[model samples]
Target: MKFYITFFAFILILSILIGCNVDQPTDVSTSSIPIDATSALSGGDTTILSESSHAFSTPAPNLSADALEKHLDGDLEFEAIFVTAPAEVNPGLGPIYNNITCINCHVRDGRGKPPTVDEKFVSMLFRLSLPNGENGETGQSPIPVPPIPVPGFGTQLNNRAIYGTPSEGTVIIEYSEQTLTTADGARIHLRYPDYTLTDTYKPIPENVEVSPRVAPVVFGLGLLEAIPEETILTYADEEDVNGDGISGKPNYVWDVVEKRYKLGRFGWKANQPNLLQQVASAYHDDMGLTTSLFPLENSHGQSQLKQNPTSPEVSDEILDVVTFYVQTLAVPARRDVNDPQVMHGEQLFAQAQCADCHIPTLRTGVLPGVPSVSNQTIHAYTDMLLHDMGPDLADNRPDFRASGSEWRTPPLWGIGLVRTVNGHTNFLHDGRARDLMEAILWHGGEAEKSRQMTLQMTTEERDALIAFLESL
Candidate 1:
C-alpha cells in the first residue's frame, strides 16, 4: 500500500510539470473572438446579418413597430427629390446648391465617391472659408471660432444652380499619380488630386480655403451619438500623457438649437453637433432647402439669395422622421470571424496598436428619442474624436474647434460593405485613397506609428491584415 501511494504521487507531480510546460496563444482577447456569438454582432441587438447591396439601408432590427414605421416614412423623405420652389411635392431645391436630394449624396445610405473625370459633382461638395483675421486673445482654453465665410459665396461652394441663378463656382479636379514602395517591395500608386475653382459667379478671394468632402455612410450614427460625452472624453489624450503617440481632441461646435457650443459628433471634422443638425444642414446646404432649425437660405449672402420666406421649406415632422431614419439604420454584422487568416490579421491589428484610435469596442449610453440605439455594446471601431491626420491629408480649412489637420475618427463598421453598397472603393474625406491598403498607408501624425508598423509587415502579414478588414 505504501509503494502504490508513492508511485501515484510521482505520476501526479509529473503531470503537473507537463501542464506547466504546455504552450498557449500569446494574443490578447479581441472583439473578433466569438463570445456567445456576440463577436459577430457589431451593433448588438440592432445588428442585421446582411451582406447584400442594401446592407446599409436596413432599419434596426430591434426597433419597435411604430419606430420601424417612422423609419420607413423617413426613408421616403430621404429619397424625395426636391425641385425649384413655387411648385408642389418637395419643392425648394436651389438658387444654388450641390445636389437635389439626400439620397443622391448618400447613395443607398452608404458612402459617396469623388466625381470621376467625366462625371459631374453628384455626391461630393467643397467647403469654402476665408483665412482667419487677428482675434486678439491667443491663450483661450477652448476656441470655438467659426470658419470665416467667403463673402457672397458663404461657407460652401454651390456648384449647381436653378434657372436665372449662377452657381457659386465650378471645380476642376486633376490627379497626378505617385508611387510608394512598401518595405515588402509592394508597389502602390497614390493619386494626388489638385482642385481648382473655375468659373465663379463672382470673382472670389484667391486665399479662400477649399475643403472637399465626400458623403460618409449614414448607418450606425445613432450608436455613435448614443456614446456618452464623458465616455468619449475618456479616450481623449490631448497631451499624450500615456506616451502611446495618440492625442485625440473633441471638437466643440456651435449648436444653434442649444445656443451654445456643444461637443461635435458628426461630419468629416465632427463639425455638426447632432444628427438633427446634420440632417437639417444637409437639407439646407446640399439641396438648398430651408428647415425650422436653419430657416435662412444657403445662398444668404449672394446676390441671387432669395427673399426670406414666411416659414421653413421642410416641415418639423419631415425633419424629425428623416433624422430618425438615419438614427435607426442598422449596422451590418461582421463576417468571417472564424476564418484563420482573418483571425490572424485581427491579432496582428491589435499588435500594431491600430486598435488604439480605431477602438474595437464601446458601450452606448441613452440617446434621447432613439431607444433602439441606446444602452448597447457596439464594435464600431472608432474613438469618435479629432486627431491630427498630418499635412498630407489636411484641407487647410479649419471648422469650429477642428484644425485643418484634424479629422474625426470615422467608424469602421460597415466599411467593408461600402463597395457592395456604393459600388466604389474610394475613401477618406476627399475620396483620395483608392483602396483599403492605400487608406491604411495614408495614415500619419497620430497614426504615423501604426502606418510605420504596417509598412514593416511581411507580405503575408499585410495580406492577413487586409483579409481581416475585408471580413469586417
Candidate 2:
C-alpha cells in the first residue's frame, strides 16, 4: 500500500512538470534587445515601407460628386432621423431599444468616451447565453434562445426610449479599488465595476448575463473587408506550430445571402464577416430599425413594442448608402514611432512578448474598385481570436463560444490618434482604462505573463514601452 501511494505521488509530480514544459519551445529567444527604429524604417517610400511593415493606409472614400452627394444626403437624413422624437407617427420604435441612431453612442464617426461624474454616457449593454459545447466545438444548439436571461443588465437594459413612454430603467454603478501584484513583482491598482440600480419599471431576472461594450472607431472598415479570407484564415492555427501559449481559431459565421458559413472577421468576437452585414445588424439591433433580413422588432418579452412588417425604415436604399459611407471612411496614419520612449516601448513590447497575439502587420486581399485597400499591408495589431483575459477583466458573459474573459485583440492602428480623430482618449472595451498605461496594467490571461514582465521593468523602460504604444 505504501509503494502504491508513493508511485501515485511520483506520477502526479511528473504530470505537473510535463505540463509546464509542454508548449515551451527550446528555441525561445530570451534576449531583451530592442529593435532599432531608424533601421527598421530606413529604406524606401510609403509603398515599400507599407508592404514590409504595418504603416498601411485605408482607402479614401470616393468623394466623387455622386458619392459626396450621397454622403451629404445621408448625413442630413441620419441627423433628422436621430434627433426627432418618435411620435405616434413613428410607430416602429421601441417595444425596447437602446437609441434611435448610431450617432448617439458613437458621437460622430469617433470612439465613445466614458461618462464623467455628472452623468453616464448613453452606454449600450449586450447579453449572451452559455453554449452547451466543449472547447468551442459543434453543439446541440447555438444562437441565444430566449428565457436564458442575461446577467446584471437583465437581457440588455435599453436605457433610452421615445418620450412620454417608460424610459428603459436607469442603471447606477458603484466602484471599488483593488490592488494586485503580477508574477514579476509589478504593482497594479484597478477599479472593479459593481452594479446597482435605484429605479426599475420591470424587475430583472435573477440570472441574466450581461456585458457592456463601448462603441469602437468607425473608420477604415473597407480595408478589413478587403483582407482576403485566406490571409485571415492563415493566422488561425488551432494546432499551435511554434508551441506558443496561444492557438487562435477563426470564427465561421452564417452568411444568409451566400447560404453558408463564412470566415468571420468583424465584431468583438469576430462574429460578423463583412461591413454590410455588420451595418445591417447594427441598424436592426441598436436603432430598432428593421431591414430585409430582420423584419421583427427586438422585444424584451414586452407586449408594448412589436415588429412592424411594413415599416419604411427597412428600405434597401438606406442600408446601401449607410454601408457605402462606412466602407469608404479612411484610417489615419500612425503617430510618433520615432520617439525614444516609443522606440523603447516597441522593444519592451516585443521582449515582454505582447506581440504574440497583437501581430504587428497584416496584408490585405484584393479589392477591385478601391486602390487604397487592395493588396495592401496594414498594421492592425490583432490576432482576432477570443482570448481568456482572466476573471479580472471577465464580464462573466458568453458570446457564441467566447467566454466572459475572451475578447478579440483590438486593432492598435491609429489608436494614438483617438484624441485627434475622435477628440477623446478613453481605452479598453468599456472605456474603463484611463490611458494606454492603464490598458497595459489591465492585461491578464494569455497576456498576463507579458503584463507582468512589463510591470517589472524600470520606470524608464515603462516610459519607453508606453511611448511605443503611443507611436502606434
Candidate 3:
C-alpha cells in the first residue's frame, strides 16, 4: 500500500511539471501583463515554437524593364506635367513644392542616398509635432493639445525648392563619437549628431516638436500592399499576453476614400496603410506633384506660394502610372547563409532575442495577376506593428494612432546592398547612424537585450555579426 502511494505521488508531480511547460491562457485584450518580477527573456521554450509558421517563399523578378513601360504608358501623362523651364506651367505641381521631378528624390526607384559632399540633393525631410498620450491604461481617445493661435512651425521643414531660390535654408550634419564598454568587457562605438540650420528666413520658435525621417527603400512595396489586412493584424498583441517584454500593437489611420479608419502598415510611424496613398503623399509633399486623391494644395494655409500661378494640377493618368511603377518593384533575394559569420550571426540574432520584434518572415497573400508577388514566403524582417522605443529615440511626433516613441520595424532584406544600390552607407530614420554597428547601438526598448548581448561579444564576434547584417 505504501509502495502504491509512492507511485501515485510521482505521477502527480510529473503532471504538474508538464502543465508548467504548457503556456498559460493569456488575456490579449488588455495591455497589461502579470508582473512576475523576472527577466523579460524568461518563460516559454523557443525551441518548440516552430519558425516554419513564418516561412514565406519569395518570387523572382520578371527581368524585363519592358514590363514597366506598359505601366508607365511611354510617360505621356508625366511628360505633360513635367517642367521645361523653372517658371513653366506645372499642373498638379506644388504651390508649396519641394523638388522639380520624381527622379529628383527617388532617383532610380531605389533608395535615396544623402550626399557625402556639400551638394544639394542630400537635403531630406523633418516632420514636426508634439507627443500625445491616452488618458487611461485602457487606451482612450487621444487628447489633442490646446489650441494655439498661428501655430508656429506647424509642418514638415522643407530643405529644398525650385523656380528662383535653392530653398530658404540648409541642414549641416556634424558628428561626435563615444566609446562604451559592455558588462562582458567589449568596447562599442556611438555617434551623436549636431544639427545646425543656416539661412533661415524666420527665427526658431521655442517649445516646438520635431522628428526626422529619411526616405526608405522603394522595392517590393507592392507585395507589402498585397498582404491581406487581416493577415497583418493577426500579429497585433496589444497586450503582452505571452509574457514577452514586447507589446506590439497595430496603428490604425483615417482612410480618406472610405471615410473610415483602416489598418496602417507603412511609413516610419506605420502612418500610411496602402502603397497608393503612400506614393500619393510623397508626390504631393516631396516633389509638390498634386494628384486627384490629395487635391488640396499643401500650404500651412499661410504660405504666399499657395497662390503661385506656376503650380499646375496633376492628372489621374500620371498618378496611376507612377503608382503602378512603384508597386511592381521587386526585392533582391537573400545572400549566402552558408558563410560561417552569417550562420553564427543568425543564431546570435535569436539567442540575443532580436527576432521578437524584427520577425524574420511573413508570407505574402494571394495577389491576383501579379505572379511575382503572389503567395510567396518573404523574409522582409519586420512585424508591421508599433512599439515604444523609449524616450531616447522618441521623435515626439504622432502619426494617426501611433504615439511618439513608436516606430514600424524596418526590413533587413537588402541592407547589405545600401552602399552599392544607393552608393551611400547610412541607416536609421534620420540617417544618424553611419554604419550597421552604429545602427545596432541605437536600438532600445525590446531590442535592448540584443544590443546589450551584441556589445558583449568580442571584436571578432561583433564583426562577424555585423558581417551577417551586411550580408542581409
lDDT of each: 0.87, 0.59, 0.59
lDDT per residue (tens digit) for residues 1-472 in model 2: 9999999999999997885443221211122112343222211011111221122222242244465455455554444344223544333555456776666665656677556668754644554343333423222123421223333333456666655556456656566787767445566677766655435566665444556677876666666777777776666665567666665666666665676767676776666767778877776666666677667655434543543646545467777766666665545444455566677787788889888778877777766554445665667677766566777787766554455576777777666656655566778787777678778888887778887787788777887887777666
- Residue lDDT tens for model 3, 1-472: 9999999999999997775333221221121322341111011111011112111111123413354454445233322444523445654444445566654544444445455555664435666543334412222234322112223234555565545533434556666788878666766677666556556445545443566677777656666776677776777776778767777778787666676677887888787867678767776666656566676544435343545333336666666665665555545534555678887887777777777777776677766645546565566677888877765566756666666677888777667767665666678877777788878888887667777787787777787787777656
C-alpha-based local distance difference test score of model 2: 0.59
Candidate 1: segments with Cα more than 4 A from true spot: 1-35, 134-141
Evaluated with TM-score, which candidate comes out highest?
1
| Span of ten consecutive residues with least summed lDDT in model 3 | 41-50
Ordered from best to worst TM-score, the candidate numbers read: 1, 2, 3
> Ten consecutive residues with minimal summed lDDT in candidate 1?
22-31
* Candidate closer to the true structure by TM-score (higher is better), 1 or 2: 1
Q: Model 3, which residues run further than 4 Å from truth?
A: 1-60, 63-68, 72-93, 113-123, 130-154, 164-174, 183-186, 196-199, 306-312, 368-371
For candidate 1, write residues 1-472 as lDDT tens digits. 9999999999999997775333111111233345665767888767877799988998887777689789989999999989988887888888889988899989999999999988999989999988675321221235778888899889999999999888888899999998888898988888989999999988999988999999999999899999999999999998899998998999899998999999999999999999999999998888888999999999886788768567999999999999999999988888888889999999988988888988989999999889989999999989999998888898888888788788999888888888899899998999999999999888898999888889899899999999888877
Model 3 reaches what TM-score against the true structure? 0.76
